[model samples]
Every structure is written in structure tokens, then in C-alpha cells.
Target: MNLIDFLFLVFATLAVGGGLLMIFSRHPVSAAMFMIISMVSVAGLFVLLESFFLAILQVLVYAGAVMVLFLFIIMLLDVGPEGSKSSKIKLLSGLAGVVCFGILMVFSLILVLNSYPECSSCAVWPTLDDNNLVLGQSLVFSTSVKSFGFGLFSKYMLPIQVAGFLLLAAMVGVIILSKKFVREGNPS
Candidate 1:
């Protein structure tokens, strides 16, 4: 395969492997670190797709800010390694997981079989064509960013606002839950 394809494969493998490792990790800190690796790998994939802006945003928002906040929370909570599960419980869980995976594979196979290629000549929305000008003629604006902003602010504004409010509420709840109350008179 080509260099780009090989790099994409490497990044994709890292992303998926890191995600699986994060899910299976017993330690919260280890899981968070794995998640960071997954996020950074995904950012690399974005770079491969020629979306440098998205790649930078992905690293900045997810790998940097979100991961730092997650690591901080994990440290603050002083979380310990999870207790080991009974062998019987593990066996049953593994069996259930295998069954679910089989079902998902079947569905995926069916989807792949039924899928058909679209007309190659059809024009994609928010065309990446150099002719489409936005704002001024001095600089050519990226249609992806422009269309994303327009869609987010116009059509999906309400849902986005609701999600933001929900996130804010959750953050406040977490802060409240983590707050340590000290008794005024107790010196011990």
C-alpha cells in the first residue's frame, strides 16, 4: 500500500487498540492515559485526511484539555484498582460479550453487503471548489469549517445549547459531589 494508507492503518489501529485498552483497564489513571492515546491517534487520522484544523482542535480539546480535566478528576478521587471479579462471573461476562460481538458482526456484514457506491459525478455540499468565495477575496475560507459553523449555529443550535447546559449541570454536580466538608469544631 501507499505511505498515506500505511500511516492511516497505523493510526487507526492505535486508536482502536487504545480504546479497547481504556475500556478494559482496571485502574482509572491507566484508563485515562489510554483514552489520551486514543484521542491523539484519532487526531493523527484527522491530519491524514488533510483536516489540519480539525486535527489541531482534536488534540487541543480532547487530548489536552479534556484529558487533563479527566486526569485531575481521577487523581482528586484517589481511585484505586478495581476488585477482581469471580471466575464464574468473568466467564459469564465473556460469553455475553462474545454473543454481542457476533451479533454486531452479523449486522455489519449485512450492511456491507447491501451498501452500494454513489454516483461519482454528484456534487458534494459546501463544495471545496476554489470558486466559492466567502467574506473577502483575499483569503479562501474552508468550506468544512464554514458549513460546520452554519449548521451548528443555525439548525442544531437548540440541541447544542441543551447539551451545553446538561454538561454544565453535570460539572456542577460533580464539583458538589467531590466537595469535602470539614467539621468546624473537630480538630482530630
Candidate 2:
């Protein structure tokens, strides 16, 4: 109806479509590109929502950092469209994916069936003058950071520590995997 609503719909559609394409694309690099498109579209939606802090974070964190890391890994591994040389486990993997999708669909349907409150009923975030000032306020003014820390430390501490541990494990795993081949080439 309104201009903001129209822009929100457009950007939301673009984000979801791009995300689907990214997930289903055959080529890894193409998927990454689609993922970038999705991230940017989501950022646009954040802007439409007047969440400038989140919009910039989405672009900088997802598009700039995460997507670049994905691209770097893709390039480093040289994984092309035809790079999936293992067809041996295709059927098993496909069955697993279908099962997981079915479970998720059922859960999502159940969630939707439980009618929720109107979107307008949700508590709206304050519209800040500038994005950077908003971010600074959130990080320092205890508006967001205090509540965030409360949630993180109170209810989510274990999950946060688990995530940190997983990241550390991933780094170690990568090092171990690469070391195997590195040692094979150099006798030293």
C-alpha cells in the first residue's frame, strides 16, 4: 500500500529468491554470488525497516566478511561445477536431505498454524539519526549491549561457549587436514 511496504515486499522477495537460488545452484561460485545477492537484498529490507544498524551490519558482516571467506575457500579449493567427483554417496545423501526437509516443513507448518500476533504489535526499534551512531549507541550506551549481555550470559552462555569451541575446533581441523598434505610434499 505504502512506498515503504512496497519496497519491503520487493526486497524481501529478492532476498528469499536469491537465497533459494544460492542453496540450489549447481556451481559453488554461482551459489556464492547468489548468496551475496540475497545478503544485499536482506540489507535493503533492513533499510526499509529503518534498521540502519542491522542493514550495515548485514552488508559488512555477511557480504564483506562471510562472502569473501566463502569466495576465498572456493577459489583455494578450485571447486568447479563438475568438481563433485563423488557420486558414491549421492543416494544416501539425497534421502537424508529429503528427510530433513520433510521434518523442517512439518515443524514450520505447525509454527504457522499457531496464529501469531500482528507484526505491528511487535516492539519497534528506535530510528537513529545515523547508522554509525546507532551502532555506537547499541554497543556502548547499554541499550542493546546490556540486554544482549544479559541474554548471552544468563540463558545463552553455554551455546555461546559451544560455538566458540566449535570455531576453534574447525580451525584446528583445517590445520590438521592441510598439514597431512603439506608434510607429504616436503621431507623436512
Candidate 3:
């Protein structure tokens, strides 16, 4: 309808389409590229939300740094597109995917049937200006980096820590998986 709504729809479509393409792709490189597209679209969504810091982060940290890392690893591994699977396996996987898609469609139809009720918030963040801060109402949501940092530290700390830990674990897992292990008796 409006420019913002149009942009939101575009970004949301790109994000979801890219993600699905990434998942279904057999080639690791193609999947990584699709993931970058998804990440950039997510950054666009963050921009639409008026969270510039998060948008920059989505671009820089995810689409830029992480994707580069993933691409480099994929290249180093010399990965190829997946080979054909057994027909039985393929049939079962296809059935599973269809079942999952059907479930998602049902949920989506339910939401549409209900006309998409307005969301309810557990905690309503306050609106703050300089005067509000001066009046000791510092815990408020804004488009500034300070409020963003406050939210990250106060409300979203656990998720942040969990993400960091997952990244560390992934790094460790990569090293473990890539390490060459020699047999105990044979030096060769």
C-alpha cells in the first residue's frame, strides 16, 4: 500500500525465499550466496524497523564477515553439489517436507482466518527524550545506540551470550572436524 509497507513486503519475501533456496540448494557455494541474500534482506527489515545499528550489524557482522568466513571454508573444502540420493530416501524426505509445509500452511491460514490480531506486548517500553532522562527515566526505547545497548544488555543479554557461545562452539567443531587424525600404530 504505502512505501514502507511495500518495502517491508519486498524484504520479507526476499528473506524467506532466499532462506528456502539456501536450504534446498545442493551446492554449498550457492547455498552460502542465498544465505547472504537472506541476511541482507534481514538487514533491510531491521532498517525498516528504524534500528540503524542493528541494520549495520546485520550487514557487517552477518552478511559480510560471517558469510565471507563461510564462503572461504566452503572453498577450502572444495565441496561439490550433493549427489543423488536413493529413491526411497528421496521419497521419504519429500513426504516429510510436504507434511511440514502443510502444517505451516494450516498455521498461516489460521492467522489469516483470524484476520491477524494485533500483537500484545508483555512489557511496554517507555518513550524518552532528554528531559525524561534528566528526570531519571533512562530505561526507555529509542532509535539511538544508547537505548539499543541498554536493551541488549538488560533485556537481550542471555540470547547474546548464547549466540556467542554457539559461535565459539561452531568454531571448535570446525577445527575438530577438519583435523587429520593419524592411526596410533601407523605414522603414515
Candidate 4:
């Protein structure tokens, strides 16, 4: 195996392991931290694929901003490890999780079987002559900051505005709910 293949395997393993750990973790904070690890590993995989712009954006948006927001929500909600439930409920939940995992595995296997290329030489992306020039010249309009700005403002302006308003409303709601709880002397 080449160095690139080795690195890809490492990052992919880290991403999958982190995801599993996040799902199984009892503590909210631990789960969030594991999610961050998964996000960072995905960014690393993006970098390996030579999508530097995407890698940086993944780190900034998901690992940085999104994770911070999640952590803030957890703190504000005063979330902690899940409490004990009845054995019947726990068994049902475990069975549901196993069934979901089996379904996911079947879908993944089908996708892999269907997507395999018939042509051995099929390339998903063009090979760059100079890696350094990929950002400045090759994919400038496709993956650069300027292109992102243009696309965001031109094609997705409405969605962006809607999302901003939704976030604002959610923040306001959280504040109102906390205040009401405090007034009622029922923090729980």
C-alpha cells in the first residue's frame, strides 16, 4: 500500500470510530467531543483528496462553529449522562439500534456493489499537474472563497436568510423558556 492509501485508511478509521463512540457515549459532553473528532477526521480525508478549500471549510464550519454551538446548547440545557430506564425499554432500544445498523449495512453494501466502475481507468476527479496551482488556477471558480461567496449570495440567498431568521428565533425561544423556568422556580 502507498502512503496516500495508508493515510486514507487511518483517517477513515478515525472518522468511523469517533462516530461510533459518539453514539455510544453516555455523557453529552463526551458525545460532542467525539463528534468533533469525527468532523476533524472527515476534514483530513478532504485534505487527502486535494480539496483544501473544502477541508478548511469543514473544519471551520463543522468542527469549529457547529461544535461550539452544540457545546453551548448542552451547557444551556444542563444535559448530562442519560438516566437509567426500565430493562424492557432498554432492550427495545437496543434491538431498534441493531435493526437500524443492519439496514444501514445492507444499503451500504448495495451502494458499493452498484457504484463500482466497469472501466478500470475511470477517474472521479482530474489529476492536477501542480498541486499548488489547483487552488489558484484549476478550481478557482469552482472551489475558491470568491466562488463560494458568489454562489451563496446569488443562488442560495433566500435559504441563507431563512436559516438566519430561524436561528434567531430559536435563540429567542431558548432565552424566553429559561426565563420562564427561572420565574416558576422549576429549573428542571
Give the winner by lDDT.
3
Candidate 3 per-residue C-alpha lDDT over 41-101 given as tens digits, one digit per residue, 9 for 90 to 100: 9999998877788899889999999899999989898989989989999999999999999
TM per candidate comes to: 0.72, 0.59, 0.72, 0.73
> What are the runs in model 2 whose C-alpha is more than 4 Å off?
83-92, 95-99, 113-187
Residue-wise C-alpha lDDT for candidate 1, range 1-188, written one tens digit per residue: 99988999999999999999999999999999999999999999988766677898999999999999998888888989989889999999999999999999999998887885565788533444545434453334453566557656766789999999999999999889989978889955
Which lDDT tens digits does candidate 2 get at residues 17-58?
Answer: 998898889999999999999999999987776556678889
lDDT of each: 0.84, 0.79, 0.86, 0.85
Which predicted model would earn the best TM-score?
A: 4
Q: Candidate 1: lDDT over CA atoms?
A: 0.84
Question: Among all windows of ten consecutive residues in candidate 1, which has the lowest summed lDDT?
Answer: 132-141
Error of 1 at 180 (Å): 5.7
Q: What's the best-to-worst order under lDDT?
A: 3, 4, 1, 2
Tell me the spans in candidate 1 whose CA falls farther than 4 Å from its real position. 118-127, 130-144, 179-188
Residue range 44-104, candidate 4, lDDT tens digits: 9988877688899899999999999999999999987998999999999999999999999
